[model samples]
Target: MAYTLGIDIGTYETKGVLVDTAGTVHAQASRGHQMLVPQPGWAEHRPEEDWWGDFVFVCRALLQDSGVDPAEIKAVACSAIGPCMLPVNASGAPLMNGVLYGVDGRAEAEVQELTNRIGEDTIISRCGNALTSQSVGPKILWLKRNCPELYAETSHILTSTSFLVQRLTGEVVIDHYTAANFSPLYDVKTQSWVDDLADDILPLDKLPRLLWSDEIAGHVTPTAAKAAGLAPGTPVTAGTIDAAAEALSVGVDQPGDMMMMYGSTIFIILRAQSQVSDPRIWYAPWLFEGEHASMAGLATSGTLTHWFRDHIARDLDPAQAFPTLANEAAASPPGANGLLMLPYFSGERTPIHDIHAKGMLFGLNLTHTRGDMYRALIEGIAHGTRHVTDTFAELGQSPKRLLAVGGGTKNALWLQATSDITGIDQIVCEKTVGASYGDAFLAALAIGAVRRQDISMWNPTDRTITANPTADYDTAHALFLRLYEQTKDIARDIG
Candidate 1:
């Protein structure tokens, strides 16, 4: 029987899994990695050290643990935290550490310059997006301006997944879903890199060739085969951004189907039959052809929980402690007794698009306990999800049922609060796998073992819980909006 291998590199760790055509995971392995915070509001990773090295280690680890022959593996696929800007030299070595996604604020000035040079309306019309910190165009411009020497040496600019795929197969390619985040750099209308725009900003030839997510880009080379314990000439597919893969992992395959990815950040993807040109939301091609997705993201979601655990619950073990915290949080009533939190610890993305937004805890009282604070944090992230869902509604592509996936799906309070605050029913999958599992599924699709529409059969889950917002909770939500509006200026000022 044939099997496939999937690997996912995330901000905190690298994970790999081995699975057969039936979707049953045979073996899995994970390795923790460090994030480089050289300075405040800056996040980076060394592609050689963290990205490639870990990819090799995890693939070897999976093979050894599973006792599966490398010859039996038909293909390998990878998914990674994306829209990362990594400058590479002619020899494909990293010119410098990768500047991470929207949370990294190193390109603040370039964002302003791009926004000023290209009027917001023009950018929205052409790129299907504005000059937000989330888009990769401003980040590329920032590299050219801030690090001239490094930019000059850059032979190619690649995202996290593209970087790995290049190393594995010697093919430089990126999928449409990942390329869309580099708007104004990629021509969304023609589904190609914007040549005119590239001449003005980035080098056209340096961009990776764009391909559909499931297309077989190349075969694993002999060198990579030796390093990864895979056979040479194994078919490798062009994978996608981690969130898109995670969406696929949970069976988000059609219009009215939405994916709520709970990870370091909260990613909301709503599918559409046609293109959606919304400046307030991100526009990307879905995993398959002839489909599009309206996307929204919060720069910080699980990060907020990490902060609370680090600052508040330092004495407790994270694995067990977070559950205790959630239990305590559940003890409190909805709305955290009027406390509202703006979960912009890193920055705000989607809807507001404010890179300078700061985290705020509003209506905190002297009478509150640690549990109340915990409840407020979960509620805060839920409110952010509500904000994104509202944007989906405005775009005429609202989800009928929100499917929750990732580590955050394990938290009952967070999931229930998400349902209650958004007033939408959420389905939690029984066997929730993150992006790596999704990448393996994509590998299966590439080999013609499964169809895209058959994803629901592989992913099955019962409704664990349904939460309804109370009248009082509705009142608090209204107040939550007003609180953020009043503090918007103050948040930016402090930042």
Candidate 2:
């Protein structure tokens, strides 16, 4: 049977899947890696070790476990945590570690400088996005200004998926969906790169060639094939950011469909009928031509839970900690026993875009327990999700259907709380394999083996979490907003 290969590099782990065109998973594999924080406000990943190394390891494992011949794999596709900033030399070797997404706030100064110089109105009009930490343009400017020597050696500025595709096919290319994040560098109207907004950032020649997400970038090279254990001539598609693939995997096809990704961060992607020009959210050309998507994300979500488990719940076994904490949180009353948390451990994104925001645990008293704090943390994340949804509603683009996916969906309390707080029902698919599973589907689509609507057959709805509003949560959400506003000045001072 003809099969396809899909791999995804995430913040904490990499996952891969081997699947037939019929959507049967033959084999799956995963590997873990770290997000290095060399200093405050910076996040980096060793491209060779974390990105390409994980790809090679996962590919070999999938092949061995499935016993599938390399030549039988018709197409290969990949997705990664993106809108990342990485500088590579002419040979496609990474000049330095890959700078991560919105979580890394090192380019705050550059974002402001460019926004001021280019004018926010002009930026929003031309780019369809505001200069934030998530934008690759400011990050590139940061490299040029802060690391002049290294920037001088840079030949191409690529995102995580672009870097991976280049390594596989020896063709430096980026998808329009991911390239949209390079505000002031990417023109949304033309759907191409331009240097008119900020010529000082980098020459357009240094950027990768842009293509649609499903377009064939190139064939795998013999060298890459040997290392990745794939056929040398297998076709590779122009991959996109992980979240986009995840949305497709869960059948987010129509304009009103939104995918709520509960991964390292709470990333949301809404399929839009037209371009959304809100500074609060983000706009990108969809995977296909003439389509659009609006995105919003929290700075931290699942990562905050990990932090609490490691630091506060040390008494519990590492594997059992999350479950135990969940049980305890369930025992606590709604509103988390009057506790409220600000999930700005890294910083805030989307609506606020406050880099100096700080994580706060308010209403803490001696009466509080670890369970209450954990519950509060989850509720805080829910409040953030509600904030994003409200913004979409204000823009008259609220999601008609919310599809939830990722590791956090398994957490009953987290899932239920998000639904309750957001007042929106969430649908979970049968295959929550996330971006990698989406990658497999994209691979099939690229080779004309499957259609976009075929995703429903591949992974149907498992269940839905219906919204259940509560007075306690309603009051808490109000305080959640007020707490941030009242204390933001102090948070900035402390930061």
Clashes of 2: 0
Q: Estimate each model's TM-score.
A: 0.97, 0.99
Question: On a 0 to 100 scale, what is the lDDT of residue 478 in model 2?
Answer: 88
Q: CA lDDT of 248 in candidate 1? A: 89
The number of the candidate with the highest TM-score is 2
* Candidate 2 Cα outliers beyond 4 Å, as residue runs: 469-472
TM-score of decoy 2: 0.99
**lDDT for each residue of candidate 2 in 1-495, tens digit (9 for 90 to 100):** 999999999999999999999999999999999999999999999999999999999999999999999999999999999999999987788889999998888988899999999999999999999999899999999999989988999999999999999999999999999999999999999999999999999999999999998899999999999999999999999999999999999999999999999998999999999999989999999999999999999999999999998899889999899989999999998898899999999889989999889999999899999899999999999999999999999999989999999999999999999999989999999999999999999999999999999999999999999888553477788899999999999988986
How accurate locally, in lDDT, is each candidate? 0.85, 0.94
Candidate 1 residue-wise lDDT, 1-495, digit = tens = 789889998988888889998888999999888779999878899899789999999999999999999999998889988889998988888998888887787877877777787777777777777777777887888888888999999999999999999999999999999998896788777888885653566978899999999999899999989887789999999988888888888888878788899988999888877788876788888877768888889999997898899999998887788988988898888878768888888778887887777788878779887889999999989888888888888778778768899899888888888888888888888767788889999999998988887677777875655767452456767777777788888877875
Q: In candidate 2, residue 386 scores what lDDT? A: 95
